[model samples]
Target: MADLTFTKSTGLLAWPAAGGQWSARSGPFGLGALPSGVYAVGRNEVTDYTTSICAAFQDGTGNGFFVPIYPGFSTTRGSIGGRLGIHPDGNVPGTAGCIGITEHDASSFHDAISNTPANVSLTIEVR
Candidate 1:
């Protein structure tokens, strides 16, 4: 299991002691901003589009919740509720309350975690 952190203020996602930093900018949440707190990145899965890696977020009740990160999609893609994961596209409005990075950076993120066992626990802290 790998623990990751996302600092909303700086739009940075990082693994402690990891070599590089990744971007994870969040989208608007409801009438204001998405609640800032800790979230768990559940089981990792391949996106339906087959262009990025994804994982469900566990809510306070430990149930799968929110949109997953889909860092491989192009900038043109938009959020589609639970059907679509968060893409790395820069357009914040398209995120729909999910974190985003860039296709190139997402590929690196995938490689970083690919070696870990399936369903490895990931912690995301939105500050």
Candidate 2:
């Protein structure tokens, strides 16, 4: 199993939660499901794109953070297409090939990942 997992069939982005089996953020990925495989998550979140408020993107729903996503050593893909990341959906309807937290639970989820110890690496598996 993967430490963090996203299921393309249902568009569910999930990770283990305290006292629970897992936690997830589900929503539509506009472009399509990112290639199924394991990906590394950046330790810190960045607002460079989300807060940019580029009318062409977000449609006025971006004001959060997203962590950079990369291919992991155990990934299933030879190469991932374009840039991949995950962020809060926050009233937005879809994403550009990235995972979006649509259940309005991104705040907590973001905090959890952000607070992870710097030495600890994060990886996500997309199925």
Candidate 3:
């Protein structure tokens, strides 16, 4: 699995790299600034969202990146939470509850976590 950190304010997805440094990519998350301290995403297994608005992404995955956020929904998000994932914001303005990566780097982001052979689960902290 991969350990990642996402900054909601800036829509930056960051992760530790081979050395002691961190690598990151920027994009948009959520249709608007929903709220902070929403919830942590325990995501595993990156999949391609073929039906997504950005499904046209030319990533090797053949579509857009779609990693299901664990718990499926957030209890921290009031009474009813929404479906969430990590995908590329290709065709639209922004996302609903999912974090979006730029279309250009969707594949790299997909490989970054999907290719790792260390852990069983991927946990991402949204700051």
Which candidate achieves the best TM-score against the true structure? 2
Tell me the tens digit of each residue's lDDT in model 1 across 12-61.
77877446577666666532333455555543753322322223232122
Q: For residues 69-121, what per-residue lDDT tens digits would candidate 3 score against the true structure?
A: 64323444323455555666555546665666654546666666666663555
What would the per-residue lDDT of candidate 2 be over residues 1-127, giving only the tens digit for each residue? 5678887676666677521122233334544556677888877644443456443233224456667788765543324444567766545466666676664434556557766677887788888
Candidate topping lDDT: 2
Name the Cα RMSD for model 2.
4.6
Model 3, TM vs. native: 0.62
For candidate 3, give the lDDT: 0.53
Per-candidate TM-scores read: 0.58, 0.67, 0.62
- lDDT for every model? 0.48, 0.59, 0.53
Candidate 2 has an lDDT of 0.59
Model 2 scores a TM of 0.67
